[model samples]
Target: MAGLVRWDGFSADPRRTEVAGVRASDGDRETAVEALREAYADGRLDRTEFDRRSQAALSATLLGEFAPLLQDLEAPAPAALSVRDEAVRRYRRETRDARNAVLTVGTMTTGIWGATSVFNGDVYFFWPIFPILGVGVGWLMQVVNRGQRIEHHERRIARRLGRRRDADREDDGDA
Candidate 1:
């Protein structure tokens, strides 16, 4: 028949001209990233080239893939300085809060231990040594935890900056 075929049965009829892995919606980003990774692994791209292409793909949305779609959903100008300032301020505040909390805990524990040793007539053990050890251990743990937290924050910021840089490149390229 020359007319459009209507499916009346449940049996599947697969078409041969299908592009197997190319999806046409926003949901396709993950699939496309996986495909790009596979392509890179297959020796189709060198490290630098693969990284460039992967970053490009990661930063682009399905809507940004075509010129028409690109024109329709143009992003606003980035507030780079504002973002950087806010990030810095936030990091400082977080670090300060952590430092204060850790020091407070260490101070309170040492004071309580010192008072107990003095009141119980065991001031011999209240010498500088064990209190220093206790405070040192507390401070060490706090610094380690703070380091982890700061590292995590840094990674998050780096990812955001990486994405923003790609966006800036795209904007410049389009201009």
Candidate 2:
């Protein structure tokens, strides 16, 4: 009767708290190994400790067994640019390119027109306006598109903020 204790929903043993027999994926092992490498690089772990932990991580079968190797270390944050930041950067680049295209097109068209008039001994026709018009229309389209993109990103940010506020309200209700 002592050994046949009634098992409840929760376990008293700390070891029993961990999920047993849950296999670690290759990605999980790689992440743990990478963390160990970073710990070594940051002088948190020496060469021998890094090697030992890395080996353990690579050879680990269960997810539970891998925890001890990286328990003391903090996971490194992802080194990715945020979507909004990247969008802003792309918008800036497109604006710059549009401006440069306009400048180049204007200069070339004006130069060709001037040279033709000079050679013909008559400054009568202003045919450069055609190419300039074409380039101007294209540049105008780019500006409009850029504006729309900025507005879209702004709306998306606002929606994200709204969602966060809603989540906070839900959390407060729970509390």
Candidate 3:
């Protein structure tokens, strides 16, 4: 018969022998324990299973052993992707708002200029051009600085995430 297959912690593929053979460190073991604690706190694991896994994690001696512990649990997402997504979202929103404001102000000024020209019985020398030009220039600047603005926005998001991560670590430490 073929070799019996088992659901290893990381995946079904047993070819991870290379990584599994590497020795685990104390910090790695503690990290696994933390993951288990989080899983248990989130109600992903029952008391009995959480206790079992927690013990196993504490005793694990290979880095590969930690993989199986995480397989059934959802892990946190990559920070870069989340931060990029947020920055893009913010950029799009701000660009849209700026565009809308430019359009709205231009339309209102044009309408006023038309009304004033009619009341004066002649063309009023296109006075709406100044306001439109100013708003248009402001929006043009925004568009031109899109890359820098997005980076600045991303930095802000990352800082906020850092603070939240620190807070979570404190909470986790307490737990």
TM-score against truth, every candidate: 0.31, 0.39, 0.52
Best by lDDT: 3
| Model 3: per-residue Cα lDDT over 1-175, one tens digit each | 2111122222222236677867776766665676676566546789999898888878877767766666677643444357888788778767876887889889999999999999999987888888988888878877999998899989976885676577669769999
Better model by TM-score: candidate 2 vs candidate 3: 3
Scored by TM-score, the top model is 3
Model 2 pairs whose backbones collide: none
Q: TM-score for candidate 1, please give it.
A: 0.31
Report lDDT per candidate. 0.48, 0.64, 0.71
lDDT of 3: 0.71
The alpha-carbon lDDT assigned to residue 141 of candidate 2 equals: 81
Please list the residue runs of candidate 3 whose C-alpha ends up more than 4 Å from where it truly belongs after superposition.
1-81
Q: What does the lDDT read for residue 24 in candidate 1?
A: 37
- Deviation of model 3 at 106, angstroms: 0.3
Error of 1 at 131 (Å): 8.3
lDDT of 1 by residue, 14-84 (tens): 12123222333443444345445444544455678657665664565442332221112222233433544
- lDDT of candidate 2 over 120-144, digit per residue (tens): 9999578878877887787788788
Q: Residue 155 of candidate 2: its Cα lDDT?
A: 72
Ranking by TM-score: 3, 2, 1
Scanning candidate 2 in windows of ten residues, the lowest lDDT window is: 1-10
